[model samples]
Target chain A: MATIAVIDYGMGNLRSVGKALEHVDARSRILVTDDPATIRRADRVVLPGVGAIRECMAQLRRLELDAVIREVGSNKPFLGVCLGMQALLTTSEENGGMEALGMFPGEVRHFTACFAEAGVPTPGKVPHMGWNQVRQTRAHPLWRGIPDGSWFYFVHSYFVPLLDDAWTAGMTTYGLEFTAVIARENIIATQFHPEKSQTAGLALLANFTRWDGTA
Target chain B: MTLAKRIVPCLDVDQGRVVKGVKFVDIRDAGNPVEIAQRYDRAGADEITFLDITASSDGRETLVQVVEAVASEVFMPLTVGGGIRTPADIRRMLNAGADKVGINTAAIDNPDFVHQAAQRFGSQCIVVAIDAKRVSGADEPSRWEVFTHGGRRPTGIDAVSWAQRMAASGAGEILLTSMDRDGTREGFDISLTRAVSDAVPVPVIASGGVGCLQHLVEGVVGGGADAVLAASIFHFGEHTIAEAKAYMAAQGVVVRLAEDP
Candidate 1:
């Protein structure tokens, strides 16, 4: 049986994510924990987060889950959701420039701030609450059963501004194109909330459980 | 692509049991809130709102249990309203697995509560439920007035401006309910819905007075709301979430259709 560790640094809604994963595949033992040993032994890992990037980083470092995350994320199949996805990037403009895990070659930016920097109109809202369609840019295992233009639940103001497009697996448009999903080797992350996204979301979670982390 | 207009089913719970009444009077039991929420979730409801109608001392504990039970079964967003007064209340609900917390009476009492809650918990989790009644007089333009205490007392606050203020104060969404058409099932107050939807940058959920599937379509099309919420029609089995989505989709409104079971 594949054991999945949903990293719990006490920042996000870990309950819903764990429940959704269990609903997707009951046989897969899903454990929500911050214990380094348990996380290290898991076959697959899920990093779920919400709230400000500064506080998220604080909690992550305080629990020393940050180093464990980097180690597990590099070795096994890993998935990140929302702030967990953003935290993998180099830096975030949120809370006066906070440094992140520096795993991915990108920086997180506010919706309007990025638009203004790029000389474009403001997107719809700050948090980008509710559901929006995710357009797949490149084929991957996570997109195996999910449709190309499936709507996923999104709730965030800041998004990853990809410095390297090679990692971009999916892109979505609000006022401008934003990185929706990024994957490379053994890692996959999405800005949208697959757990809250209904059918397509459940399908994606199912795919993740079955994924071997190949391109 | 345009975001799909959501059809949310609301459950008014009193001591762990789902109940419905006319304007908060003559209440009768409906079913278990957790069971009803799970049924709606399986039926393809976009979201579920569990409102603790009787937010009594022990009712909080029951509501927490209902939320936990429902959250384990349901996979979509859950918004809990009624008796959420402070940041701690909001924290308790979120910890109980609620995606959003709706503040009405307490919000009116302290406008700063909206700001504080939004700041503490990201704005995406803060929802301000505004109960409004259309006020007509020579002194002011034909506008809706904000009502608190389940629409029994009027606050004299303009609905449109109050919504804008709430949004500015960091409210991620607004749950606007029309007191006049709440239980009448006539239809959603489109004008009122439109006024608030247009006034705010955040998403607005048009609630109250959902009689038929057509009313739901109108709530999205005519009212320009991001989502439409109904209770009695769905509770009474007049329509299912799939039925409402089909009607809205046929009317050229983008709604998430249920996949084949």
Candidate 2:
């Protein structure tokens, strides 16, 4: 039985994320402790988050899980959800001058100014809440069995600007095209909350659990 | 790019159990909310709305346990409505794990409540549930008038303008239900739905008058609703989630099909 450890960084939807994993018959534990030993020993890790990017990074630093996350992402299956996924980037435009985990080469920027410049209405919104469809960029193990143009729940105003085409697993349109999901080797992350994405979300989690860590 | 249509299942909860009957009477069949919520979750439901039908009569405390149970058990987004009168009620619902809080009568009495809740919880967390009935008078222009207290009293507020006002006042979403069409299993009021959808930039969920899968599709494609919220058809097992999504897919409506459960 694969033992999945859901990193509890004192933020994000903890209970619902755990229930989503359990729904797929996976043994899961919500670990808030920054103890490296427990994370290193787990078969899989889920970094779930919600709120500002700077705040999330600060919490990760406070718990000292930053180094642990880097170590685990190199060799094991790691999943980052919402802000947890955003933290994998280099930096963010939120909260004025805060660095990300620097796992991926990109910056998290706000959707307000960009949407306004494009002449889109309803810009500068704090939370982009509702259901939106994800356009799969290329075939990947994480999106296996999930159909093309599947709608997933989203609630965020800031999104990741991908370094290149290689890092993006899926893209969703909300006023404009935004990176919905990304993947690199053993590390996979989604800007949308898969836990709140219904069946497609559970299928994604199931796929992550069965992944052999081979990209 | 066209917006994707949403499929929503509404659960009318009376004392923590999902109860349904014609015209919202006589608790025909009852099942645990957690059980029904899990079923909807598996069915690829875009969102779930829990109308606490007994909250006002039974008090807010009883509904808290129901919301907590469903929120803890179900993973998808949850919206709780019925008897949510004040900012405190909205706060309690959100604290109980409800992603969105729906307001009806209280919002009608004091339109400021919508703005107040929106200011406090953010517009995304505030949903205005409008229950309207088509007026019969020739001078009325076939408009929808807002109904209050479980659709018992008429507020004479035009549903169309009210929808626009709600959006302007900071409502993230509008759950519009036609009282005449509800429980009738006839079909949704396409014109009414289109009117509201056009009036608001925010997403509009069409509720009431869903008889079959085709009705659900029409609710999305023709009615211009961002999502279709159904009750009796889904609760009575008339059509499973797989069937609905398959029907939707065939009709060119983008829907998340059910996976192997």
lDDT of 2 by residue, B196-244 (tens): 8878867788998889999988887887787889888888888987788
Candidate 2 clashing pairs, residues 3+ apart or interchain: none
Candidate 2 residues A95-182, lDDT tens each? Answer: 7857888899878877766687678764422356666778888889988899887767887767876457788888877676778888
Q: Report residue A57 deviation for candidate 2 (angstroms).
A: 7.4
Estimate TM-scores for all models.
0.93, 0.77
Q: List model 1 lDDT by residue over A17-94, tens digit each.
A: 999999999889999998999999998999998778888899889999899999988899999999999999989999
- Worst ten in a row by lDDT for model 2 chain B: B252-261
Compute the DockQ of candidate 1.
0.51
Give me candidate 1's TM-score against the actual structure: 0.93
Q: Interface RMSD for candidate number 1?
A: 2.5
Q: Candidate 1, which CAPRI tier?
A: medium
Segments in model 1 whose C-alpha atoms lie over 4 Å from true places: A114-123, B138-140, B259-261
Ten-residue segment with the worst summed lDDT in candidate 1 chain B? B252-261
